[model samples]
Target chain A: MACVDDKGQLTASARKLLETIENNALTPEEIAKEAALPLFKVRSSMRDMKSMGFVTEEENGAYQMNPEASKLLKK
Target chain B: MSEETMSQVNSLPRIGSKAPNFEATTTHGTLQLSDYEGSWVILFSHPADFTPVCTSEFISFQNIYPKLREMNTELLGLSVDSVSSHIAWVRNVKEKFGVEIEFPIIADLNKEVAEKYGMIMPEESSTETSRAVFIIDGQRTVRAIIYYPLSTGRNMDEILRVITALQATDEHNIATPADWKKGDKVIVPPANTAEMAEERVNDDSVECIDWYYCQKEI
Candidate 1:
């Protein structure tokens, strides 16, 4: 998410993160630990995903992929 | 300094230039600059192996080695000394100061790598290299350069700061402010057009001191 190019494609790191998050709702820390990425990376990824309406933050600050994003990304 | 020597000193690779590639004998054996292609490099030089200032700098560099590695940055040290000298110096540092120097030190006895990197200050001592640090990115492009007089030791904090700042800017596509460290708010580039500048101030996502200066957390 942080390295998005001019063409608006997800960066390799972001893709790794997204693929790491499949079907799972998790906090940034959890996602980072699970994905074996840094916490700041997960935070940036979640922020970008949230801005793009691809993810939503729960009351506990955990994030989950939106149905629209899942369907769109499924393509 | 002589005219010829001054010209040699000033001939260093500028920022954004490709790093001069080299393969030389190191404490760890023969190594090449290209071996570190997929990682960031902090290629540095010191005056000699057993000098006081250089010894302190080496200890400090070893202190920050773990942190640098976690950030995918490697440290490369060089001096116009022989490999045996480097090995003895590393052992001496460990035995005397109890801090092991793990990074490979290039034994540039022929001054090939030193001259290529402009580490040899003919003015300082043709036989020794002055303190020089080059930050090279994963693509082998020189990202930043710092030169320090041989008398003064390098600041480990500043070295860490520069690495952190450089990595942060690249990853987030933002610039760092003066005295910026990790977790500090980062500078957002100014808008390119007049309309964007007006909209930028009102965007509210970033705090702006003026239309030209805006900062946001990453």
Candidate 2:
């Protein structure tokens, strides 16, 4: 599980990936490119975030920030 | 395959490019490039089997096989020869020269792997591949590519030396001087700006001939 803090913030690589992901559902490749991070790093972080319920995978293989996590971020 | 694919495969793959993948029959059975992932591989091609020069090269490569294995590297040979021909040639070498061929040889009857690696030399012999060597690293990147005319054989010691240099350079993040071997001091990357160069010179950990060029022991 990712070390998400009380402020709904992910730590280390998970935090970097969470910051890159947006609500419109971006593919991991696009996120990696936008963040200038390696594809493997993006993919591994995505896997961890998805399992931790901080992110969601869409049917088209793109990722979106979970609505609950998004709400928490706003607070 | 399209013209783009033809151009990509027919041309010699450049160093540092991802090695072109292939699956083919070998003396050991069905083999694929992916099978050797995470291990250094020396993929080489000979003009033909049972020839004197090729026989000597094969013997030399076999002699260094154990050393290469100690370095976590594998040897793979290729030619535009059939499986039965490869088997017969390997058996003949063992019987006549008393050298057991332990490594697998690719049976590239259709020149499949040859075209992918641009091993076939039409000028030398339309049917046979030239003596080509590609040193692929554990990450599947082509580290080095060497070619010798069909008449000339390769130096296995030189190949081993190259692998050592590559591994050392990667591990130490330093460059190897020409003809460099293990335990030799390695060349450090030159500083970028004037301020860094000043700092580099005063750094006692490294010996600098000048502000730019430095040598260090790893």
Candidate 3:
């Protein structure tokens, strides 16, 4: 049903992580490097975004933006 | 706090009590326990994702999903893993086992659902949930609860049989014998009065081994 919060908002760190995964699936380390954030922050943001159904994990332990997340990005 | 006190605080939902409700992110979508208000729910929790035992259990659950649906039941799986891990595991299971898990799996990283369901047995493992199954009826009341140690896999046939038995008992006011299956004779409730006990002896419709033990055909 309501996949996102009432505000349909993503934190700045979450948005950075989501943008990195929007094109290619990447592990937390890679996302941190690409987003210029620390690895620990990327990891925590990924967990938060994942619970919101924004990103999904690949078989290789890489994270990618789900379709629901893509829609959010477009909006 | 003492172990006993901690356990008492996180005790499992008792049978005949209302199932605790929660909103969780799942593989299918964000869903609440109230979503399946008019159907039976098999809310099960595994220890983790990608583990061998949990993987096999997921496959087994997928195999019986159709059968359960036929009985107006829905399956919802849970683990303390993140949603990303759950998605990865689901894909892996499909590729390796050739069984697609159609049911939604709750990603309980916060352990909200697990704590409410008393799935995490502290004695077993503080971080992971034990193999727990809660069968909630259409009315959202818990009808049965089965818990297995982390090592032992659950029995699908037994789960199905119990659902059948519960349904039959509700429909006919009867009880099921040990190892009972569908189409088998069901036991009648024991008579409480002397006259009813006497009538049970003369009731040809039922087979009575004793006054308290009587069975009738469904």
Candidate 3 chain B weakest lDDT stretch, 10 residues:
B28-37
The candidate maximizing TM-score is 3
B16-132 per-residue lDDT for model 3 (tens digits):
999988878887656778766667999999999999999988899999998998897889999999989999999999898888988889999999999898898999999999999
lDDT of all predictions, in order shown?
A: 0.84, 0.83, 0.85
Off by over 4 Å in 1: A1-75, B1-11
In candidate 3, stretches whose alpha carbon ends up further than 4 angstroms from where it belongs are A1-75, B1-11
State each candidate's clash count. 0, 0, 0
Tell me how many residue pairs clash in candidate 3. 0
* Weakest 10 consecutive residues of candidate 3 chain A by summed lDDT: A37-46
Show model 2 residue runs off by greater than 4 Å.
A1-75, B1-6, B9-11
Higher-scoring candidate on DockQ, 2 or 3: 3
Q: How do the residues B98-178 of candidate 1 rate in per-residue lDDT, one tens digit apiece? A: 999878889898889988888876777878899999999989999998989889999989999999999888989999999
TM-scores of the models, in the given order? 0.72, 0.71, 0.73
True contacts kept of each: 0.00, 0.00, 0.11
Best by DockQ: 3
